[model samples]
Target: MHHILFFGDSLTAGYGLKNAKTESLPALVQQKIDADKLPYHVINGGLSGDTSAGGLFRLDYWLNRPIHVFVLELGINDIIRGISPQTTYKNLQAIIDQVKQKYPTVKLALMGMEIPAFVPGSFAAEFRTIFRKLADANQMAFVPFYLAGVAGKPHLNLPDMLHPSAEGYRIIADNVWPVLHGLL
Candidate 1:
């Protein structure tokens, strides 16, 4: 079976849900893979409040496995912490580099995030474009804003409004599926 790793923060982890294994974006995607009879195993590598730098630190562990596809959904945490856009970019680049080095033929994908509306225009603009820049630089598949329609839609999120609810995860899974399917 092919392995597709979904690496990200709490949003990808299905935080606050009663059962992340069944309600998380990765799990939902796995369900789709099964339903469509696709030969792929979805691995959830998300952690609550994980930043790109944090992901870089732990990525080697995940790389120990045979990964055919890697979907990155990081950077938001870094942004939330007021990390420089340049720093976030470097960390994400390092993460991608490690994956490419380990699995030269791996199909890579980037799940983009948008900076909150109130952030400074320059910083917001820079932070927002990191994924596209990375995708273009690495020639990886890209999902522009996985939470597009669901973000800020209070009903779609948990009470914190920072993490997606089960319903929101379902929408994200649908958003990610088309690009992920194309990678196969």
Candidate 2:
């Protein structure tokens, strides 16, 4: 089976879920793939509270096997910690670079985050546009703001108002599936 790795932070990890294996985006995508009788094998390389730099550091370990698709969902944690957008961009770019070096033929997909245009500071704008910039530069399939219908919807999120609940994840998966399916 071809391997597709979903790598990122809390959202990818299914943070508040009782079971990531069955509820995470990767798992949900796997279910969709299975229903379609696809040969892709999904791998969840999600780590809670991880940042772009952290992902870069942990990348090599996950590179042990050949990967057909590599979906990157990191960076929000870095932004939450007030890291510079440029630094996060470079870090994510580095991760992309490493993955490309290891699996030259791997298809790439980037899951981006966005802040409202009204949010103050050049930081918000810069951070909001990083994924687009990266996607354009690298020719990766892009999920522009995967949290669209789920974010800020109280019922969609866990009590903490951060991570998505089980239903929220379903929505996320639906949002991601099309772009991901295209890569396959």
Candidate 3:
């Protein structure tokens, strides 16, 4: 069976959800696949507060099985932690390289994140460019901003105002589906 791996941080993990299995972006995408009668299984590889380095460190474990489509959504934690954008880029590149090296034909998608407006514009710009640059360089599908419709909307986000709520995740799934469908 084909597997679509949603690999990233809490955003992809459906953080604060009462039922992540059914409420997460991966699961929502899986539902779409099911409705369309597609033969694919969605796997959520999200870890709360995970950085690009952490993703690289744990990638090997997930690579054991065939990954038909890889939706990469890391680096937000790196930005939040004030990690250098250069290091974040390098770690993300390493992760992408490892995936391609292991599964040459797997379809890849890069999900971009945006830092809060409070962050310095220059730093945020550099951070935001990482995903697009990686996607362009690697020839992967790119989602410009993962939190497009959900970010900064009080109703869409949880009390923390960072992670999405269940409805917010649904909107996120919507934002992701078109890109993922094109890849499929």
Please write out the lDDT profile of model 2 over residues 109-168, one tens digit for every residue.
999998767789999989999999999999999999979899889999999978998999
For model 3, the stretches where C-alpha displacement exceeds 4 angstroms are none
For every candidate, C-alpha RMSD to the true structure in Å: 0.9, 0.8, 1.0
How badly does each model clash, as a count of residue pairs? 0, 0, 0
* TM-score of model 2 vs. true structure: 0.98
Global lDDT of each candidate: 0.92, 0.95, 0.92
Best by lDDT: 2
Candidate 2, 182: how far from true, in Å?
0.5
- RMSD in Å for candidate 1, one decimal? 0.9
Which of candidates 2 and 3 is the stronger one according to TM-score?
A: 2
* Best-performing candidate as measured by TM-score: 2
In model 1, how large is the Cα lDDT of residue 40? 96
Q: Candidate 3 lDDT, tens digit per residue, 1-184?
A: 7999999999989999999999999999999999999999999999998999999999999999999999999988998899988999999999989999999999999998877668776888798788888989999999989999999999999999999999999998899899999988
Residue 34, candidate 1: alpha-carbon lDDT: 97
